[model samples]
Target: MTASAVKQGQTTTGHALPILSLAVGTFGIGTGEFAMMGLLPDVARSMDASIPQCGNIVSAYAMGVVVGAPIISLASARMSRKQALILLTLWFAVTNILGTLAHSVGALEFWRFLAGLPHGTLFGGSALTAASLVAEGRRGKAVGHVFAGLTFANVVGAPLASLMGEYLSWRVAYLLVGAIALIAAFMIWRFIPRDDPRPGHSLLGELRAFGRKQIWYVLGVVMLGTGGMFCVYTYVSAALLHVTHVPLWSIPLFQGLWGVGMVVGAYVGASAIDRNPLGATIGAFIWNVVTLSLFAFALPHLWSVTIIIFLLGGTIALGPAMQMRLMAVAGDAQTMAASMNHAAFNLANALGAWVGAFVLASGFGYAATGWAGGGIAIMGLLLFLLSVRGEPRLERSTDSSVRFH
Candidate 1:
């Protein structure tokens, strides 16, 4: 379970340490990223803006990811994965530090945008790095383990960080995140293997990744499928506040439980994907459709809502499944395609938030997020089915390697 053991890929030693390190880094990032939502009232009050206006910060950050992932991934393709990760984490620390010191809403938004520039690229590169270090059949689990760091952040880091912000000051949370990023940078530099940069890995080669059709299909699946989850989750706090009648003090506890559900879902999903990736994805999507609908109905009862939230977390299994599926389909352009997966998911994040907000603004009530989410899940399912059915059959002499854009 130690970092050293994880570095050695010793399955028996628990892989816990490296996962913990990854999780710690993710914890800081998640805390800094998500705590803003909970602290919106405080941020708006301090900056003298409306709640919706402060939401512009979130949009700005997402735009950063939409712009940053491909640029960073291609620009850094020539570097070793480990070195790239370290460099990315270093930038993470700097941007977050600036975020903590911003004097105005405009300044804060700018810094938050900068802070997000490394977000998707970091996860994409880290997932690839984690996969490269593991044996076959365990690759999915390893990637899941690394991502568990982020998921755990939901359960533990975000709630605690938000509570600290609520009790103390939001600025303190950003400080903690900056410090953790620094630690992750140091750990990545020290423990990660040193390898020569790839030969002729140019930005042009990376851009060529778009030449394939399957890539677009994968992206479609990711954006639509995962968007459903975000539609509900992006508004969970609001739901609890308005419908469940949970006290502000109890909000973090519920959110933390959702995180725990994510952790369990992630590990179990990893195992399932390793066994049968395609089947697992389909099943997970279907499961999301059903559970998310049930979640909407249970929202009025606190105890039932909590359990439903945990069940809803199971939808995260889609993440690893889609990620692995993209790897299979991406061929030589694995790097950019992998990085783009996170980009696609974040796009889902933006879509889900916008749509859910629109529904709420239209007077449908807070519980509309679940219906919004379920609608998204069903759309994703249809797309997946079409993708599979539309796949062209090959002649005996022709080759078939799943190609991804």
Candidate 2:
């Protein structure tokens, strides 16, 4: 067959299956990734380590995201997106399996880092595929649908997996993740259309994304904005235990509720961005800041805290809007930008957790994290406003290519 025929075949196949496959793969990744947080205390006890020492696992994962995203996006520039995703997920599956057998904190941390290596690249590449499958006006929504899988993980996977770890063994959670990843890999291999690798694409060209100032602005906003959620989520169990005083059996309820919030947030945010990108972005930041503040006050009263947690999850709507913003400004470096979105979130994960830890370490207690989360959200809002003020380095053409009513 002619090379063009292969390319055409790949594109057609991608249209039919790659998007759903990507979503499924992301679901596995999301489950594997966040499940660790809920299982942290268990793993720490098993390894005879301190809780903070165990936090190194989370740090290791975030470090992998930070270092691996750009490198993978650039290094795989010559490969088909389909091939890249398959390889990434395979690696993800292997590392997760290895993580199940870790006997020491150091070993666990190393494997966690390895597990994280493909996260950003997978999300970015999968998103690119998802976007290509849709009409121009609907690209954000398409991408959002894929992300909804990850959000669903937060509601369903994380809570259930965490409960499993809490009652059973943390190793079981890792094993389950591995099984899910293997399934995702199979789905990708079977469903994702095989695209011919872009011949002219080069690592150097993708790395040029760093030259754009707008990219940095978007990254900054993403780091601060999304970090707000992490600041609270990372400590939610503790809050439920310490402040809300929920029974042990009901702890999963909070995690599940948080997931429910995420689902609603993703849907609302996805639809809102389809209508008004800018408004959605700014509104998400505001909602996070306000709701998080309320969350702090409500922690002492369980009913109010439940309401706040729901709202806390809802603020996740900012995720898709911010991702679409980066796509708009990223020019030809779409892969790098897409991958960097997860990197940004991982960074937020680290940042929010560290800040929350600092507050708790200082004896302020778990509820202090809400204030920190709110502060981070407010910072994100400020950054978004700055972007709106014509910061030359961060400006993208306001071309209305994808008109929304």
Candidate 3:
């Protein structure tokens, strides 16, 4: 139901229900993924592991995203996008349900990795499908709307899961995440309209996309820019504990503020991208540097840290703009590049959490993670500028987007 698809009398776009369903799945994924950041302390204590040791689970999950993106994208190239989305959520559901059965840290890492396997493909397919539904210029907003479910999860789902982990059994929290993912699968199966298989996109062509340096630069921008956010966010609870000296019970409540920032960032960033993709991308990197630097300074003051966490979540603004940028330059390998986009993101997730853990293990305070994150963001902004100096910043027209039979 793209603009071109509509003009061709193939399909007209107004399928809010399908997009809603996609958002639901995104929400479930976000809840399960982000919730762990706050609940890692609980997990660490339960497994009799150190907090830094427990952070390996985050890296494990992100590694799954990195490994799974390209493999699944290639495997599903001929399948219906709708079918792929449903199966990915089902995969997430099963993994999380099984994750509750894990007894040791190794087991926890394994199940979390399985859960991560579906992460990149689901987001990639969801973004592409959402783009297919909208027109040329508005694709950024549409993708943002679909991704809003993730940001909103930070507000509601992740915080709620943190509470569940704190008060109830953390197992119960994992069980709840599984249940939500199951519901998302059902919603995807029910709401998303059927479309025939896309045949012309060759798998070899997908590989060819990798040869382009722009794609690599885009991936690097996402990885570095996003890594900074995860560096602080992955250890938010610890910061609250050691620095802010806030009540332990207040962790989840404060975590909700981060989500509010994400929700705001998504809309604001999407609007900016709709007008100027490169400019939005530039501003997003700068935003991360400022917020992360502020977070380092603000950690001791509870109120200031709270404000900065929200602003830090605003780094999510880079997501949509970067996503659209990939599709624009990918040409025939749009699907592959789109899927790899999340691969890069979770790679960032892995790198960021690992770096955060590293900084902490080296005796740096929790606040030092912010300084590290700011430095990373500066590197990302510089790399991005170097990548796009001679390239066009505009997204490709809807006419270039995939058209289904």
Candidate 4:
């Protein structure tokens, strides 16, 4: 069935199952992606590498996301979204198991990179599928529902994986993630509705979506705005240990609190995005500036820092609005643009970590990361302004039905 046929066939209430199934897949991806942050110490010890060297593993996974999203999205453009989701989840499960079997840091990094290959594609596909299930005006909420899994991972999956890595083995964490991925694959196969392949959708048609100036601007907004959060988060464990003087057991607690904030933010952001996507994006950026900057000052007091961490996690509320913005601006190439949103996020991951590592290496201290993050958030706000300024011209040139708001 064509997209219109599928859309017309479903009632709003019927969307629940498919969206939940997609969220399950996203939960697994989120666990596998962020679990490494908490497991970095164990991984470093196991591989006889320094903490910073283990950071390379995070960068490697992010690099794969950046490289894989567009390739997988375009390559699978003509396939049914259902088929693409299944294949992607299967790839995710297998690669994570491979990660568990790696005997050396090099091998493990390679597997992590391979495991990350499906991350963006799965999210992009899930977002598109979820959006299709709902009414047009409800697309932002649909997308947010899918991303809630990622946010919830911080609450449930990442912390559990971290605890397991701490008490058992880091390898056990990967094993658990692999299990979750397998379960997600099964749920996706059982629950997600079949989407017919886009008629006449070709690589060239997808590629041409990049020709739009607004797409580039939105991508820039993602790359810059989202990097600040990753900058602070990538090194959060180190900050908790060294700066806050927290015990190992307490780290996951803070991480879980952050996750709670994310859950709240996702729901809140969904409503905000549905109202005014551009305004929500700008507001999220501004929120990032306040929280990240405050984090620097809050570091000296554990209680204060804890609150800041929770607030910082809420910055992710920006994601659904941004995703919706890309959908509106992408025109014909929805798959590539949607997938590229996560690619841009992981690129922020790499960029933030690299920049944070540099600042730490320079002896500015762990708290300096918040300062750097705050600066990056400011840059994101400026990009949002630039995009806003150009909106009128972009609106005239594109389809009138696809409103950025």
What Cα-based lDDT does every candidate model obtain?
0.78, 0.81, 0.84, 0.85
Better of 3 and 4 by TM-score: 4
Model 4 Cα lDDT, one tens digit per residue, 130-214 = 8777666677788899999999999998999889989998899889898988998888888886666755786786787689887
78, model 1: CA deviation in Å?
A: 0.3
- TM-score between model 4 and native: 0.95
Candidate number of the best lDDT: 4
| Reference-based TM-score of each model | 0.91, 0.93, 0.95, 0.95
Deviation (Å) of 81 in candidate 3:
0.8
Give the lDDT of residue 396 in candidate 4.
28
Error of 4 at 146 (Å): 0.4
Model 3 residue 291 distance off true place after TM-score fit, in angstroms? 0.9
Ranked by TM-score from best down, the candidates are 4, 3, 2, 1
Runs in model 1 deviating more than 4 A are 1-20, 390-405
Candidate 2 C-alpha error for residue 379, in Å? 0.9
Error of 1 at 230 (Å): 1.4
Q: Between candidates 1 and 2, name the one with more favorable TM-score.
A: 2
Query: Of 2 and 4, which scores higher on TM-score?
Result: 4
Each prediction's total of clashing residue pairs, residues at least 3 apart in sequence or on different chains, is 5, 2, 0, 0
